[model samples]
Target chain A: MSPEATAPPLDESWVPIRVHGDAGGLEVDWCHLGPERFTAPFFDQTVEDRLRHPFALLFQHRTSIDALVERQRIRPGLPVRGLVFHMSRCGSTLLAQLLAALPRHVVLSEAGPVDTVLRAHRELPGLTDAQRITWLQAVVAALGQRRHPDEEAVFLKLDAWHALELPLFQRAFPGVPWVFLYREPLEVMASHARHRGAHMLPGALGLAPREAAGMPTTSLDEYGARMLARICEAGLRAFQHRRDAPARLVDFTQLHASAADLLPELFDLKLTADERQHLREVAGRDAKNPVLPFEENRDEKARGLTPEARAQTERHLRSAYERLEAERQGR
Target chain B: MSREAFERFRARVLEDPTLQSALQATPDLATFLVLAQRLSAEQGCALTESDLRDALDAARRTWRERWI
Candidate 1:
């Protein structure tokens, strides 16, 4: 048989490289990954690593995506295996990295292009819910292109802030399973106190009129506490309103255990004993700092919170934290 | 503009708080290009809106080429 006989047919539409700009206007940075690029063991690489492949030919121009559907003949993405939403500093990345280690899975851990459109939903106030949903579907379709024929599922670990936009995403892909990962509030805050993510910093997300109206103070710790609580609240609301979609709340404590047991069932993934072992090994390292060995530091993390930050967490985050814990315990 | 000219202009903008604010406050590409043109000129780098667009394109290419 000719090699062409077995090769997957190429769809000529460009893979969107990233989204740029705000609500008043939006632009998609598009690229075409040349034939043979996806045929390699590209699934093993990180999203950024795959994106950086030299075989990609990027368009110099940006498009408004007004003609996105007409211009791109996108293959419907592999049945989305699961979506991972989180409170920042949780073990969500570890979960994604473990899933990515599975031979048949394509995991995009916080891919920048995906985050771009989600953030644009807020930055561009003119974008209606319907439009954002359409744009999100297109973005996922572009990102979830099966790089290798063996790939069976694609998982997305969204930026933490995505919890706030849960309803919109649910509207976009209602059939996909979703999970929310969270750790206790003080531990999460303490981790941030050591080194803050851009989202946790004040003014990163320009406040909405509703949020701006209710804020009691704009101090760093207060802002962090309020933002973290809102993220937790959003997760709780989504899980409560899951309706028919498969959704679960995963505590940081349950993560390692779930790697072997619950996660596969949740995502409809089938893992061999060997594959499960490989996943267990991956979980033993720092998911973000994969070069280093993993260490258990929960006690250390709890101790790191100062009295002021601890008091702030207790004041602003206690109810949300208790609520998440209750749901995780199946209460 | 050459890559060097764009780099110089970008550096000057970063160093000046007012220019940074102007860039941050820019609502869209049209405004950004106008600001870039003015800043480039103040730094003696001959720049036009077209040149600024080319510079952005060049930067993207440079980022991709680094992977190659």
Candidate 2:
């Protein structure tokens, strides 16, 4: 493909990269590659491009943490100590907003480059471990550039799919502390049904063919379980395989109930009286935002999993939650 | 660290006071060095290895006492 043809249309911010894989299946447009090339193995003109043409708008927004890190304007010598991983539609957004309200942290929400990297990895078969490491390095570099030299800590909230890339992130930022947020599976499914429609539900979660059509299917409940399992698994496995290296689990319910009381202790930061007060007020006001409203339409809820089929989902989640508690207690 | 490097680091760190306090209280050279090296690498820029190494040493000592 010629540079122009391979290149996304000038106005387009994301160009689809075809992915061939076994578990996720071979597919076109599985992931996106940015126009800007930072490293050799990850992005190149022959396969990709460097800044020869004016930067084609590759993403709608500059939320790519990697791109921000490349800007090199971020202050140095700050203590960025937190990463938040979550299951979709849990209260993660609210938690992130609460954390961002703190005076001492900069929270980057659901940045795109990480997702792009994961998609590329999954789709493009035969990527060597070294190549994978280099891609991850590129992502870390992107995040580093986005740090403001003046900010002491940077907190990143990633999409749930990022859970699959936890091992890579653990290697990239070895010692950084992290927390995973999860809600009850039924609630998560209900919220996802309400917001993402049929698009986000994974197929193996017992989705019907019509419901699964045109949707990205992964083992949602199974993957969610594995993500929790990785976090709770003891020692270096938790550190090496879990995305939130030095990980902790925060129940969505608990976070909603006691965020103000818990955050300072967990993050090792002292919030000023005013900051604490502000956080409480924000939490209280947002509590009514309806985290997982029940869907009155049975058809909507039934799209992915039949009532009978969903029993397995419940069993999986319960097992995962139990394992997480066990891991958290150092069992 | 050079004045320029320090300033860049300072600006990002100071964006949040809690981080500022943590850095000020700790002032570990190793942590700063690691961060600086990582930042430079990410930006596709280069820094003198000696400078990064010095900062890393300082940060490690400080973090051991404070965080670890």
Candidate 3:
């Protein structure tokens, strides 16, 4: 075989599937998939759109960050426009999907690879703070490759726990606009009580052993409420501390009424009238289950909260929630 | 990694209550491997470290190849 034929493909189309550290150092798993695979939803592997794009295991091996950096130096990616940090189930997926509906926008909604890198920082072998932040930048750059000429912006909807890691992200993407999407404590608690998110479960978000020690495991409802409060507290504390960063506190209530106009202005998204119209249509559908029509879930969640549970949430999380709400209202 | 090896590991984790509790209590890769190794010993499955690593890599590859 010719030397060229035996060589691995080094193209911008390939993106990092996962980033982790081994005994040697940092390594990234890369897989090549066409841009269309990204443009469509991959939440459901059974979906026709997703099934059509069967990504081959390119080169049958992983690549190092040095190789990715060399590849990126040849073909740089689009700069990130904004970052979305949410308290989970607070219309974050909706906002991300809305932006994704627009053809010119690249919105990464709670991308697992990014979340894994962020969560497994200290756990990964030989990962120092400096190297971790550098790796984060490289991962985002690889994911932000502008496959289409019209692609103008790349936005990240970080995993909710990432709200706690705001400082790290700020250092990675300096001057990028960000927002913390939050809802009332009771509302968030009720939603979790109905169906617990992975983060709401004990130790799911990589909580320090000391932090998890305080949680009351006997009552799953109380445990969930306490865990959620910690997440909200972390977000509120970060938002308050990073006052100089281009940050905003967006209430869930405001999103339904004005995200179409507000997000563009806040995030500097220059959407055309047609794009706005399309976004509105996308917004009308359930973000998680797109086939279902969007229904008002707040009222249902409020009704679901038991009086005792509501009191428990109020006792544990209300103060932090109130503080966040005050920030959202510009108090 | 063979599909059956992956499926067996998943099934054992799900069926063993003690393993599930240990997993939830300490949700890290190190702890997970330790639990899987114990289970593999009892089940007589040749679940080597390489097998687990290959399983993780294969799972990641499948997720990227398919998921959005």
Best by lDDT: 1
Expressed as tens digits, the lDDT of each residue in A83-162 for candidate 3 is 99988878888887777777677777666667766755556655666766766777778777887777877888887778
Candidate order by TM-score, decreasing, is: 3, 1, 2
lDDT of 1 at A322: 95
**How does model 3 score by TM-score?**
0.75
Q: Candidate 3 clashing pairs?
A: A42-B68
Candidate 3, residues B1-68, lDDT tens digits: the string is 44566566555553455654554443356666666667666766657666666766765555555322
- What TM-score should be assigned to candidate 1? 0.74
Candidate 2: C-alpha RMSD to true structure equals 17.7
lDDT of candidate 2 over A82-113, digit per residue (tens): 77777666666666667766645555566444
Off by over 4 Å in 2: A1-79, A143-150, A197-245, A287-306, A329-331, B1-68
Give DockQ per model, in order.
0.03, 0.01, 0.03
lDDT of 1 by residue, A129-219 (tens): 8877777777777667666667777788888888888998788878789999888888899899899866676655555523632476656
Off by over 4 Å in 3: A1-9, A20-26, A37-61, A212-218, A306-308, B1-68
Clash pairs, candidate 1, are A23-A124
Indicate the residue-level lDDT of A136 in model 2.
45
**DockQ order of candidates, top first:** 1, 3, 2
